[model samples]
Target: MGRLATLAALHGVATVHSPGPDVAVPVPDETVVAVLAALGVDASTDEAVQDALTRAESAAASRLLPPTVVVWTTPDPGTSGAVLPPALPRALADLPPGTGLRVETERGDTVEWPSLDAPPTDAAAPGPVSAAPEGRSWPDLPLGVHRLAAVAADGRTAGAVLVVAPREVPQPPPRTHGFLVQLYSLLSTRSWGMGDLGDLAELATWSGRELGAGFVQINPLHAAVPGDPTDPSPYRPSSRRFPDPVHLRVEAVPEYAYVTGQGIALLDGLLERAAGLRAAVLDKGALIDRDAVWQLKREALEIVREVPLGPGRRAAYHHFLAEQGQALEDHATWCALAEVHGSEWRAWPSGLRDPRSAETGRARHELIDRVDFHSWLAWLTDEQLAAAGRAARDAGMAVGIVHDLAVGVHPDGADAWAQRDAFAEGMSVGAPPDAFNANGQDWGLPPWRPDVLAASGFAPYRGLLRGLLTHAGALRIDHVMGLFRLWWVPAGADPTRGTYVRYDAEAMLAVLVLEAYRAGAVVIGEDLGTVEPGVREELHRRGVLGTSVLWFERDWEGTGRPLAPESWREDCVATATTHDLPSTAARLTGEHVELRHRLGLLGRPLAEEQREESAEVADWLGTLTRLGLLPADGGDEEEQIRAVYRFLLRTPARMVGVWLPDAVGDRRPQNLPGTWDQYPNWRLPVADAEGRPMTLEELAASPRLHGLMSVLRPSVVN
Candidate 1:
């Protein structure tokens, strides 16, 4: 076995070696190491072993359990119900020795402290309950969120008051709503190889005013690690706390007009190239060239950095620096380091790889200029995002822009490297084996250690949320269940060997709610898999919206039937599809399954199942016809699209999402899962159902597209 594996096995056993109340002391090192390794720790090294022991100790110390007993006074069991003064403290303190005490009451309840030995019967005669003790009033829980009902002393009746422990609540931002769109699928005439922010603004203006969309929800715009065939999945971001500047509309940069001084020629050329690139995507209907865009932007930014910040701009820059502080510094530092060390920090020089070592500090000072450039890029990206949100609002979007929060960042990237102490080393976040993916999938993103996060008051998580939510009217959290618990795949183990690690859902939720409340943003959880029981209920109670996708909306527990529109959950944002899956047209026509088959992604041969599935869909269409939901033959395609919207209108969902591509009959999905090379994944342009490229103008004028909009107008207005 490798040295690290050997050490990890030893550490695992040693860490779990706690002598039970009746067992012997000093468990074997081998046993402990085995247990520690199972938890994804390499305990071979002395340091690793020590770390495991410390973690175990910390977990034990922080473990919370329900109170042993809860007691309160009320009318005598058999007598006429009468108002009574209860001896609250005595009843709590007099519990059997070793029993934990929890005393709860309604607002304005009194606690008269006699001795701990005093009985409730010894208190004064029944009277109105005294005012609540000073500094003891229950904290104001989130309004409009659900709370679990408290049980009274009789066990047969509900308590008069409800006290909820702080938890994450997904509350909609105050009086705001907007349309949601997939950015790449909303191609414009001006886009280089794909859609840009300029197109986004126009779409927002049109949708907000014409369609009355409250918000414009978009996929995650998180920075991707720079490389060839750059990771197309936005969910695997280099850093969740920073936006990718590649999304910036080059012409939108203020500095673009001021290029004339030293290094100005270089920037001018790059800008010209960027403009050409945009022209190609918009004019020719080509695939998005992310690497090309990044190359051009990087060169332009290099020159822009040379232009000294004007006094006023300098002040703004300083303000941004102050706001970002260490987080920005760390992210920029990681970027600089990546230039020299590549994406995997572990492969770098030992001294430089350790984020806290003196060697890294020296490297930071040496690469100070590069770091500043990266920081500037982040600041500019932030400004544009805020501008987009403002534009949406100015155009009368009620909810403005809703941004997506990726579930995690790349393990070897900025956030993980910068916040190593906060993450569980050698462990990766993933899903447990399920029907969809029997082998399970490891995300290769490190997970936060619950104890460590709690100890630090969730500062890292809070900072990330604050950055994403700063200008967002609403935020969608990918894989929201991770807030409660995450399946941890230990490094070097098959995904099946991994186990679920619990988190303090209350604390995590509290932090999320607090941040969202501060940012005036609503929260939505992408809860779409093998969710534990009560998770959806808890999310609904917290006012956090859940995601209800058209394809998966089925009554799995009963006779398996696609969920009726009216039966959809009200506390959710209903959408036709998402970035990770095939678009609506593709699903309806079986293009996705065909593509998967072509890519050899099917577990079974496609020939056998494809025919059967196709027939099933035909039958489904027949049902739609029976329900009067199908369009008449020979009408506009938009008429058929309108039928789809009419179905959504039947649902009671508070918010509805319109995939940008669907509005224009774009056949290609923004992404295609399980294919890294055969498909462009995130690079496809918005195209029509016939696979014809459509520019922004053509999209606007398309009869099929406009017809769909006509159908949605009445429902949105109502």
Candidate 2:
């Protein structure tokens, strides 16, 4: 066990702190062994541990450079006119004397590093520690993903990925306020029962141009795993790489314009059904049935597909196919196969289990039409996403269409099947036991294999980011700590038994910065809960903004009171509440406590929970009053909500996000974290104060919403 721990630590496979910093928590031996096994290391016994450790040490010693190297130029604004020194990697010190080094930049440029003095050629001797060539300085290279190659004097060749990134991501142009929404919960008159990319475009344009807002941040649009009863939570998606076709605005498809006669009659029937689906949620108080909506859209899409694409559109689609390449094919093929067999690939016939098997290939070939249909769906979805971005930009948004990225992929989803070798087998991404939940959490998503990711030079990660960034002016990464480390739970194990598995944070951040730079998008990390000590600092250093919710901003280490607005960090998106938490009205009215009690989700006595929640609200209200942002006599519900925005506006935070529901006093949380079937997790439409479902048009006209928006307006705030 001790040997395993030692080797685990050596391989960066274990962390002392999973979510806390006060006590040193060692990962259980069982967890360490399991995680090590996932990394392709055998550590089940003493003999195996010793053998693995020896091989690991030998491999580390023999390697002149790591599989990937990240170089970030520290931007010093003070040195305005002076040229700064190039950042150098310390691994250069480990290179053998007289070893030749070559750097191939992404732009087809190359730089050479001449060899230093030769040393002894003793095979058993340790790696050379000679200094770098004294007179030579690193070449000023363009920021991008590059390649590095090293040739030893003995003719042994080694290669690594060289990533040159900006020290920080570009920040938003100015302090601006925006709307934050669970996109699925936003229903419009034109939507097919639920919010689609069309709704996003309309909301972005109206909010940005008409309301003078700066951006519209929405939930993850990632693809969902298909099932009889599909999981509706955006956070647990099938693939983080592709947007869901269900969100496609069917009417916006170019082919929809050409549908005629019987096809048009068929579409009318589907549209009527869609109207009922939308009415069921808005008027009848029925849950949003994604499956029902998709059934209708699927039929309508088939008719639309029959209309041939014009030459221009055909060329554009062919270009998209060429660009997306094999990733699209694999994803489309998986979807096609899922329709025939089942969504869960694990339960499929043994011959079809492997994505690359002959049987799977044959199935893909036989179902080529279905595969092409799915592929077309993805391309249409992509076009709508791009159109949404264009709408936001045209509406004068500073940061338009800020998209959220899910943390991981579902175990039986497309990415898991296509990139089978890149995910850890039989392990789920989760959280360690923390103060909030003694049992912790298991997200049921497979984490990427760090070793495999490094071996592949993080191509999957880079590709996913590229896809999302294509139509995003800013990207929010959910549970951003996963980039540094994630809790790996053995399938079906208690979350307490899970342990932290470290990732190559340098490489991860470098890839993120490089992509964000190329896309000209801002990056925001959801760095809210149980963050490690230095993670926030590291993110800030790289120009990534952190999330800061008002309720969680109290000084825990000090006065246990509301933190002063002036003390809040500037590199954050400050908000009064998030989608997962209670709305401002619910908190102020103590309605959240009642709701939790009604749902039997209260962790303690209802009275005690109410008292604690009430006291917290009082503390913040007092702070707001002292700041002269609220009336001393205690304001009305709408006034208090506006006061909360005023408090956030006073902060130095670069961006302020107004939860769309909060504007209209929606009290229910969009998500109740611990319970699945116990609550309607992601089925509710955006509602008004009285829990009345609202359409985009109605929300725009709502007096309460407009009242709240007035408080956040730059003219009023300034």
Best by TM-score: 2
Q: Which tens-of-lDDT digit does each residue in 620-709 have in candidate 1?
A: 455455567785452244555556666666778878777767876667766676667778777776777777767767866676666666
Quantify all predictions' global Cα lDDT against the true fold.
0.67, 0.86
Give lDDT tens digits, candidate 2, residues 415-486: 999999999999999888778888888988998999899888788999999999999999999999999998
Off by over 4 Å in 2: 18-21, 74-85, 105-134, 154-156, 714-718
Off by over 4 Å in 1: 1-180, 184-187, 261-268, 282-286, 631-637, 715-718
Q: Candidate 1 overall Cα lDDT vs. reference?
A: 0.67
Instruction: Name the weakest run of 10 consecutive residues (lDDT summed) in model 2.
Output: 119-128
- For model 2, what is the C-alpha lDDT against the true structure? 0.86
Total clashing pairs in model 2: 0
| Cα deviation of 414, candidate 1, in Å | 0.8
